[model samples]
Target: MGTSLLILGVALWAGAHFFKRLAPEKRAEIGEAGKGAVAIALLISIVLMVIGYRMAEPVWLWIAPFWMVHVNNLLLFIAFYLFAVSGLKTNLHRRIRHPQLSGFKAWAVGHLLVVGTVQGLILFGGLLAWAVVSVIVINRANRDWARPPEAPMWKEGVAVVGALFLMLVVGQIHGWIGPWPFGGA
Candidate 1:
């Protein structure tokens, strides 16, 4: 049942996201209302995914070494940093076309490395695939990309600091919900 719910959530989430790309005419016809509907579906899918993942029985596929946790942390840092840079006017933003999606890909891959359970694989793998496809589709859709103005160095420093703060907060939340990221420290 949990697995089924998870699968359904993934399908709904992916479908809603891809709907615009798949049916641009339909999306345009719906207009702003379509965005709201998609947002609602995305919210519901997130809730379902969380509940389904927690409810699902763990079936270990492989054992990840303890060292992988460190690597996961590093990836997470990079992910968060990218996410922070995405919102800001940074020079990195000009170089990385899809900062948020790239962050998401990194995050999903990091989680997949640390979590080897069946549910983990299904959830993280699905997200990773979605992020990859999104990047590809978006790139294809926008062939001639215009470069944005570069931000100041100070702003980049601020983004890094903000990302670090966000990471700490996320680590705390992870500790509250599941295993502590820093080995229960």
Candidate 2:
């Protein structure tokens, strides 16, 4: 049941995301309404994924070494930094075309390194694939890439600090919900 829900969630999320790329005319037909529908679908899918992942039993495919946790933490830091930069008007944002998706890729890869369970593979691997495909499709859609206007450096600094705080909060939440990331393997 958990696996089923997970699969359904991934399918709904991916399908909704790819709908615009697959059928632009149809998407344009609905316009704002279509965007709302997609947003709702994404919300539902995320809820389902969270529930399914929590309920699913871990079936270990391979045991990750204790050292991998350190690597995962580093990757997660980079991922969060990228995610923060994506939302801000940073110089780095102008250079990195798809910072958010790239962050998602890093997040997925980091989790994959630490989590060797079937559910982890299904969730993270699926998201990794989606991010990769979305980046490719988005790049294709917007061929005329140009540099964005520069923003103040202080804003970027603030974003980085916020990202670090968020990472710490998330880590605490993860520990409360499941295995403590800083705990022994």
Local distance difference test scores for all models: 0.90, 0.89
Can you write out model 1's per-residue Cα lDDT over 1-185, one digit (the tens) per residue?
89988887887888889999989999999999999999999999998898889889999999889889988888898999999898886899999988999999999999999999999999999999999999899888889888779788887898899989999999999999988886536
Error in Å for residue 137 of model 1: 0.8
> Residue 159: error of model 1 in Å?
1.4
Return the TM-score for each candidate structure: 0.96, 0.92
Worst 10 residues of 2 by lDDT: 176-185
Which pairs clash inside model 1? none
Q: Please state the error at residue 6 of candidate 2 in Å.
A: 0.9
Candidate 1 displacement at residue 107 in angstroms: 0.2
